[model samples]
Target: MIERPDDAPGAGLSFDYAGFGRWYDSYRVEVLDPALVEVEAVVGGLLRDALSERDLARIRGPVGRVKSKPRAWRKLSHRRYVDRIDVVDDIPDVIDDLVGIRLTCTNRRDIDVAREVLDALPVADDGRARLWLAPDSERDYLDRPRPSGYRGWHVNLGLAVDVGGSRQPVSCELQVRTLLQDGWGELTHEDTYKKDGELPPLVEVLSRRMADLLSTLDDIAEDLRDELDRLDEAAVTSAPLPLTTETEGPGRRAAQAADAAAYLGTRWRALDRPVDLAALAWELQRDHGAEITDDWFGFGTFKRFLSSAVPAAEITTGRNAYILPADPVPEDDAADDAGADEHDGDVPDGDVGGHAESDQTTRHGTTGQGTAGPGTADEAEAAVPAAARALHRVDRTFPLLGHDDWTRLFDHLAEAWRRTGAQPPTDRLARRLIQSTRDRSAASGPPLAARHVEAVVRDLVAEGDGVPRPADELAGTYATLVQQRLVELRLIGARNRNARAAVRRWIAF
Candidate 1:
């Protein structure tokens, strides 16, 4: 327990501005400021990241504030310290709301998500979280409203603040509230919360009545949001079924494989882009009441892929494995080329490789090499890698094909074959479509479309349903689509498995 001074009720320590001000200023500069920065960086950042742009649009702010000298003095002068916090040593705990970070969400779900982000925060390497919720510090005003009708959720967060050179533990408060609740609180904040004295009967009754009405509004908004989300979900899940069906061929194999999403390439499966260990650990602790450090290793996965190669070699595998090749393959020209252009097809961060790209720039910007300033076409051609130049040769000769362009061409090809009982002259059709797409590439379509290839086989044999359609050459296209779908499904399955495995590891931890 902190030994606090119990000064006189009237004007005691209130008039001594210099003494209080000096302490307050030093405390604010040294302790409060760093704690605020730490909380905002860790808590505020995580909350904002948890919410999408749509959610953020509805949310007001993760805004912060510091308690003034008067508020701190008022709380400290109490006979027993507010929550028995040390005023001199633990100012942040004493003035729990010394640094207030408010995230006023428009609805309840966003508020819930914001709180979950903090509640499930993982501890750092020092066996501590940079900012953490202090025990017994949460106040659910919304669930149990105050007498004066204020509604909000608050959790006091302890921060590991680094003063001049040493580590100082400090704390702040995080407030989450719906827009309506925030408005109600705003109206009654001063009247209800500030003064220690009792409020008038009329004011008290009206405030409670107003709060109940706004609470009703908040509930309605949440229901409406849930309804809208269900509708959107239903629409997305209602994608068109596969174009064709097959029973006794590659198409059938593809159909089965694609449906399972469990047969993608081994390398792709292994590299399901590892999940955040901290997040995984946090989830484990929250859901299962198991604590674990955010440390994950992929040695098990590595052994699964490459252990067979060294079974005959006498080696005892430990936590760390150092594997050397029994026979090194000689590097040839093809290998050299492959190595040089290994990352050629890769999509850089923020430069996604897909159609439906609007105002999109490639690894090479708008006008290939445009982002690389002041270079003539000849100069660019000279400077550009031979591999890259070769990669783009086909695109320069042929016009880029958008999703619509490919669909139209495919439809025409099928129609042509059906009418004549023979493959049509795709050269003329291809030429015409290329020109059409080229003319409108800038005006109406993605400029870098067709940089990658993907075939979706939903809706080929319009009559297939789930049964195998008549064996036709056109059905071969459907087979190809099925093949593509199988690969995609495998990748998806691998990712799902990886996620599950990650969670399991955390659970074990």
Candidate 2:
């Protein structure tokens, strides 16, 4: 039996050790349900203590993937235990990173605050009491960084996972890093380090040099953060004091409402998943717009507002589920000349959100905002142009995923999501994103990109569309998905964004 890793209320309570007998065993996926549980349970605890929006932004991962099968085998094949029984009994210690939740921040100050919060984790039994943390479980990379220049804060944590209706103890690794540190990893292709080989001497030397440079940048970033904090404090102090009628004036109230709506609207639109209520609340309060929505956010007033200008059904998964109001009808501007100023090169009508092909999916018993209902994938797939499907294929040796392909693919995904009401598969999308990132030796440094990969995967898992991708043939298909994402910027130079940005980086010789 695995010993308890921490003193959380139900840590490691009668967990099924036999469940993880092999890397590819049936329970491999089953055991992963806890990783999902660990991400939110931990992050939410951190958020409850955040004093400001800047503090909230310090922790950006909704969560990333549970380590994949191929990656797991690479990790344990010779590194930990060779036999299954030894591995299963001491699971928490052997696989300390089953669920890796990265908290990427702007500066190191955020990391200090996060460490303080971790001192009193919210208990999981009912999300209330403080879960006891083992003081020795923390690994501080900053104090003794890897010679390769790697830097981050790591900690092993324990929590109970619900498996087959039984509460079982599980574990996760919380990685706290500043954005600059993450970016250095991305630019350096550091993720491939998990695959078990030292980098070529030239690459390693360059990576180490960049790591040192990034460390200096981290110091500069802290200085910039201190300056910003001072400015923010100054603004609050210098603000006009509230009088009998000054604080909540009608004009002030309207401005606040408009500001919050616009900020949240744009942010939600950019994300592939929902923003946490705590994060939303903090930002709203910072902007002085918290009450403009409602008093009790826990009731989902802001949640409904967040979905769209109109009310939408809450997503069963407990993240944000939204229903956008229909596009406003274009008015005939009383003159034909109103159209004269429009660009002739305006994305062709069928080229963007208005694809005629989506109509086919809509007609196949799918409503603009109704569930595609489990069987709609086939219908949705069949409805898309064959050329669109053809473009998903990778050349393996050359860049093949293109802009037009991405345009149609996004258009199709947008339509499927719109007609079916189910969001597109973002976890697979994140995997695809990670794959594409790994394939690009030409991509930016490894630090930030790696962290972003972790951050995006976390949110995707929390949201719906849990499309499971096989770990086989990963090398062949790696670049296909991320290249599409690079081109997913609403079709404005996105194609070139991937191609052009590749050479734009300055790597050390």
Candidate 3:
């Protein structure tokens, strides 16, 4: 009766312990691996959708195929068990599961975009996320940069997911960044974020400085990219002219070819043309003439022409050449000897009368055909010189007046002055003259009388005397002049509020 039972002795207990060990191994294989796989697939899908929505093409490849690798576990053998005999209680409540995704990009901006895309993803209520750019990552090694200098972004996300049908949750981690950052991280991860005395003081300081320098260099590169974009836009918008039969009339065509040759040849000459006149003229003839002829031309054509005809350095430096039209002469006069015979005309004998006739004759020879008289040519020529000189001065002083139209107008005024022997008009008078001329041309009619231009000029001069005209005040005067002309042309009523407002804005800088 006192003999040990077959199922109750030490031998039976040993067999039970062996069976429990086998069951624990089976749980890890069936439950833990599959749970981790599911979590990884869900998170990966979330990241891919976010990046795709943001149009971040660079991160698409890396995010779409992310996975959790090599499941890891920590055993809490001493912890309380759920049941007296259950081994599941020995497992820790939170598993330190880690998953990461890597992205590659050409520039740092792409890295930033990836980081933003990840942050925007919908996270579980119990999850937490963090983002780091460049140097903040573990892979960033300032002391030793990679040969390729690949820089990138990083993100650390903490997610909580259900496992094994348990009410409790497990924690998981996620990381995102570029290939360059990943490489850098791999190299320096051990030395970074060490609480122990792993990283030496000197190395840490040097690493920080190098990181700062690299960041600054990246910023500079971005700025250069922006500048290149602007230059490309300018080039596209400023392509060369075209040539066509109607546009390339024999006479104009010859003149255009000669002008182009002159422009190319003058590259070696000093840029001291009397008013950028030569440069303005050449552009007009080449651009407008070729356009008229329906001849297709581009930057390459102009560049090639300049390369052969002009100095290489001048063409490289972008020095422009202009070819102006022959200065407009009196209807009956020649361009070169226009005012030379002013004193030869029949004249009344007196300083007042003779001087007045001589002045009128000189003005007549310089003004455009059919636009000269007692007061017309004198006022027109007077304003022309000052406007031309002002434009020239501004071009040299400030960097404005780069527009071809503005420069061409200046050249025309200078030519008029040269042919008329006229003095520069006051600024007020010059402004009025320009406005009147533009208005008349737009209406396909003759300009206002020179006396009328003079009156407006006199009013402006009086107003501007001893006072710096605020930009608005000057603009207002031009607006008034435009409105008055528009009304005189009978195209619009004087009371048109919309027209007045538009003119005001147009005349404003």
CA shift at 112, candidate 1, in angstroms?
Answer: 1.3
TM-score on alpha carbons, each prediction: 0.46, 0.43, 0.29
Best first by lDDT, ranked: 2, 1, 3
Q: lDDT tens digits, residues 89-128, model 2?
A: 4544566676667778778766655654553332223433
Task: Give one digit per residue, the lDDT tens place, for model 1 in 350-405.
Answer: 21111112232212212221111111112212222212222122112111222233
Off by over 4 Å in 1: 1-17, 80-90, 122-128, 190-193, 235-509
- Using TM-score as the measure, what is the rank order of every candidate, best first? 1, 2, 3
- Per-residue C-alpha lDDT of model 3 across residues 18-42, encoded as one tens digit per residue: 3444644675465544445655565
Task: For candidate 3, give the lDDT.
Answer: 0.36
Candidate 3 Cα outliers beyond 4 Å, as residue runs: 1-57, 60-97, 104-106, 126-170, 178-180, 190-197, 224-509
